[model samples]
Target: MSIRSYLLFSIYRFEYWMQKINKKGAAYMLALQDVTKKYGNQVALDEVNINIKEGEIVGLVGPNGSGKTTLMKILNGLIVNYEGEVVRNESIGALIESPKYFEHKSGLYNLKYFNDLFGTKQDVGKLLEQLNMDHYKKKSVKKYSMGMKQRLGIALALTAQPEYLILDEPTNGMDPSGVREVLRYLRRIAERNNIGMLISSHILSDIESLCDKVYLIHNGKIKKEHRPLVGFAVEDKDIGKIEHILLDMQDASITDNGIVKVPKSESKKVSQLFDEHGIEIKQIEEKSVSLEEMYFDMVEEDYK
Candidate 1:
């Protein structure tokens, strides 16, 4: 090759390599590499590694005392005396444990106090409206319901307009409707702001619905990572025939009650196959495995 051509190729390759490196570095908003935490030799966390990237929601799930909270605390800088590298590339907002507010103060006053403390000019009124707490903004926190207070805590977390959010049980102690409201707002906020979030929750259904990926922790370590399944049930009178058909298909299983569980993505194909085979479908309902089921499965395996 000519000397000029070789020089140009080398320059192009150098630029490409630099761009790749830059992209990799900017991909994750927060990363914990080989992080470990201990309390008087009782290992609260054992070399935990987690990464949260832009515009992604990651769920942390485990039973009590299983290092989920410890991992979150480390990420939030609550437990700082830990071992490992923590890379936080952008501003963070966190709501860990119970939010302490002056019971006598109005919700708006509490928010205003935090806003000033964070040195942010975020519009408290707008935030309250977004969280559906505007109506009760003037009411004292002591009079607020559990769900309302939870929403207020989330609003406090957003006072800083952080690039990453860390929430531990953001919906704890809420009724069904309250849980739905909190999850809905969280989803909207994450999408609209392009924020990455690390959420730890005991409610598996909330995790399964809201998270793009899930990490299961146990015994101070990450036991498993799971992509939650979107399950579909196919039921018919001839259970044996349905089982045989599903057995031939990938990612299909028959439950103990003769219901066939297939991936939701393949629901159309399964329906077509059933029709072609003259299997009169009684019902085909979409469902998901509860987080409780997945958690217990992992825990049981670990104990065994």
Candidate 2:
């Protein structure tokens, strides 16, 4: 092989090895041991213990009153209170908030300062370039738009190249295009660098897109752990179609709140018919439960 070809091959191999090393150490990047957060009489997080692996994309989810923000704060050392141990390694990158930057300073200037503080000689320009923000490097923070600011946030978070990244609503205030860009870039980083990410978003669709595993927190406690809830969301028109099909087929019945429950003998048959008819199924399982269904069921049971 030519010398240049050999060099490029070696570089790729080195990058792969680095990712492998990061992945190997990702078993327990962050561990929350019996943690609880209290705000006066309210329980923000009730004795929640969670272990996040090093190189996994774990999305934290919950309803409006859920403890996603609290859990993230505890993980990022932003909230020092609560009971239980928040154990994390030294190298941790947190975008828990849209961190303030020097309004008058160029983006590059900001990275230089951050790199100095972190005592790491990372290539700041290349990092910005990788995030497609190199063109915006010389501009002051004040000149950047909100979406640009989010892009800058991502660039800053990756500057440390920490194995663990904590993102709190990473795509908040972003347009659809911006959200897509951020998710794509994050996935690239996670795959390339084996960066373990803890992403929290109130938008279930965003969480579904970015994470393979999700943690659902409700009532200050973890309601679901490491479960990817997959189902279809058929429109009202499609719902009627599904109902009609179920009624005519006799193997399945529509349960309360529009859930189509199927007997084990005909789950596959029901799924095939609906899929063939272009019925947008919110979800279908042989005998699997869903987050939405599970929540409503629990609520009804509690009321009783």
Which candidate number has the best TM-score?
Answer: 1
TM-scores for all candidates: the values are 0.72, 0.67
Model 2 spans with C-alpha error above 4 angstroms: 1-27, 229-304
Tens-place lDDT per residue, model 1, 1-304, is 6534653664565444333222236457688888888999799889988888787788999889999877876676555577777777677788888767878989999889878876899999999998888899999999998778888989888998899999999998888887888888888877778899999988888888788678899989988776544443444657777777767666777777766666543566778888888776667665665667778999899878
Candidate 2 has an lDDT of 0.71
**What is candidate 1's CA lDDT for residue 248?**
64
RMSD of 1: 12.6
**Which parts of model 1 have CA positions greater than 4 angstroms off?**
1-26, 229-292
Superposed Cα deviation of residue 70, candidate 1 (Å)? 1.4
* lDDT value, residue 92 of candidate 1: 77
- How does residue 99 of candidate 2 score in lDDT? 72
